[model samples]
Target: MPQSRHLATELPGPRSRALMARKTSAVAGGVGTTVPVFAARAGGGIVEDVDGNRFVDLGSGIAVTTVGASNPAVVAAVQEQVAAFTHTCFMVTPYEPYVAVAEKLNEVTPGDHAKKTALFNSGAEAVENAVKIARHATGRDAVVVFDHAYHGRTNLTMAMTAKAMPYKSGFGPFAGEVYRAPMSYPFRDPEGMTGEQAAARAIAVIEAQVGADQVACVVIEPVQGEGGFIEPAPGFLPALAAWCRQSGALFVADEVQTGVARTGDWFACDREGVVPDLVVVAKGVAGGMPLSAVTGRAELVDAVHTGGLGGTYGGNPVACAAALAALDSVERDGLLQRARAVEALVTGRLHALAARDSRVGDVRGRGAMLAVELVGADGLTPDPALAAAVAGAAKAQGVIVLTCGTHGNVLRFLPPLTISDELLHDAFDVLDAAFAATSTTTASAR
Candidate 1:
């Protein structure tokens, strides 16, 4: 088998089109999709569709499969655990695998200080729980988040999130006391502004609008994921963390998309030396299984009474077993180094592409998590249509890509670490062709 993408027919082939028709009738309209093909099976870096078309999986299911979709170790662990037992509800009957996963999270997450872990079912749930812990511990109410920050979709998380359409539209009357502040987006910020300066701007907003002393926690993604893969300027994180400490607000790092070696480090916060007091992690943790965790300082997390945080399937045995195996694979496979290599390779191609094309406004992100922001002729105005067109063209060529950003003008990549270099180069070749074609088509249409 060729290890890369191979298109057997046009995208959304006969089988996929029929499935789509069924989906339109059965699935809720609120739940949308990308690529428009039905995945039959996936492994390593290829997602094979029902029609037998294979796609170079650059999105990694929104950065959930860092250890690969069908990681052998994860599959084996899950199978063994499932054969033994599926779920007993840890809260009802404590389990060994659940405890083991907590121990692993406490040890691997940043901070040498004594820490504890609580498992959850999704990033949004974990984030909401993290806030509950912080507010309970500090005896405060306000939660601070940054502009372009994507925490999650639950009511509380939606309140923390910045975007309006799709995520927040028609979902009003959100949870209260969640405030937004400016982020140190290097690309969009004033060119001369340093990260320190940016942090000061945000701090001023918090102090004035929200009153820092009243805040319970300031949650942030070390590298903003859905909001365009924006990596904040170097000093920004450290400064915010410092302010949180000084103001008695727990600094929470939402590591859902950037954790578990996806960003060339165990967690992106480690790269900035910013040790968050409370860390919420999901996405890439269980190699494709659903699992999330809130691990942080022992004192803060323990402040809440026993049984304060839990869910029916927070840490199912099979999921925990998969997580343990996935964490092992990260260390054993040297995925951290692999992600860095991906960053170097992909960014090199993107930079060259940006140099040749004025619409390629910026190339940003860290490790395997990267993005290319599309723009108009002015090189500053967002060009979402162009981004959509490029992604569509790439999908037509059997390379699955994704787009994000507040304006939806950024093309993001999250290829599994196990993807071969050959596939990476080939995927870029398709992207280059897609960009050129889309730009020409857009120009001709105009």
Candidate 2:
């Protein structure tokens, strides 16, 4: 009954098993789940399953619930909005909450330039609209992306994403005119390649393959989220942004997973003073409410004629209210500082683990967005099986962890910013135990 994790039964116990059976029958096969247990309640750092098992949440619902899954302020705002009205379709009736949320986004997002904001239902929708606006403004055809990037799952975003298998495989004939550029992954880069050199490499390819003038936008996740939490080499982002400006191509920052204090900054671009032309935001923006947005230069955003960029449920009144509350919580609660503290706590432990375990290849990321890549005995070959074993081990011990990366050899940790230091340390304890156990088991098997 305590807030901390307490297992009354094995994971996916009798009640959870029954619900899983029901879910299998009702939900489509493509809709995947990380854990078998069904959540009955979740708050702070713990999720209580239907069978009375509590888990320390490290994934934060893939970085959506930064202020906590059941933040009181967000809940109150949603309740108040619902009491007034649910939805009148913003395009038809229009509401103040939607406008207020947009105004907030314009104010908080980087840069002092004249800015405008448009809301959407998801990260994919926001990215799609950003690309649309860029193409319209530039009158260009091609969009540029990067390797190991994860934009979203929609057709246009799928084309933007770099990985195959789960995201792109079988979903072919993707939207055309999307070009992929090499990213500056520090851990995997050539021995002496500087960030500037890496940028030049990608720029050279962009110029030759996708003419700069012919490109509409160069979209990137300042800190690649689903792509192994890859933080570009120090100067990589600044160089890319500069090139985009010189080439008359807009630089878009997909901050879906890194925005709203997740990376200890308003946006990951802020770390290097790289102010993107267009910023796509979601995930943590609404405190788990379904809301996403595109905020950018007023001129480029207004380039599209009226009625060209809106959706019926794009900025649902309820969701906007939640966003407003969530943003307030971010600033009021000082979640930015908390995110940085989490980075120090997690990365410090991970670095120690790397020293002990050969399988732990690299630990990287900013603030609360951190990851440890698993490697084989050679210390260079990706060991996805080890990552899976570690994650599974953590889950079995009542700590929720998630794995990511194109190779599926990275363990990503995105605990809510509101999580207590005690809970965070406890989760790390579980992860350490998981890694130790997995290492021994693998060695014995070998």
Best by lDDT: 1
lDDT of model number 1:
0.93
- C-alpha local distance difference test of each model: 0.93, 0.92
> Residue 186's C-alpha lDDT in candidate 1?
92
lDDT of 1 by residue, 164-194 (tens): 9889999889999999999999988998898
lDDT of 2 by residue, 1-446 (tens): 35597889977799999999999999999988999999999998789999999999999999999999889999999999999999999899999999999899999898999999999999999999999999999999899999999999999999999889799899889999999999999989998888899999999999999898899999999999888999888899999999999999999999999999999998888999999999999999999899999999999999999999999899999999999999999999999999999999989888877777777888999899999998877778998898899999999989999999999999999999989888888888998898888765333211
**Deviation of model 2 at 392, angstroms:** 0.3
Question: For candidate 1, which ten residues in a row score worst on lDDT?
Answer: 437-446
lDDT of 2 at 282: 96
Write down the TM-score of every candidate. Answer: 0.98, 0.98
Go through the candidates in order and give the clash count of each.
Answer: 0, 0
- Give the deviation of candidate 1 from the true structure as CA RMSD: 2.2
Error (Å) of candidate 2 at residue 242 is 0.6
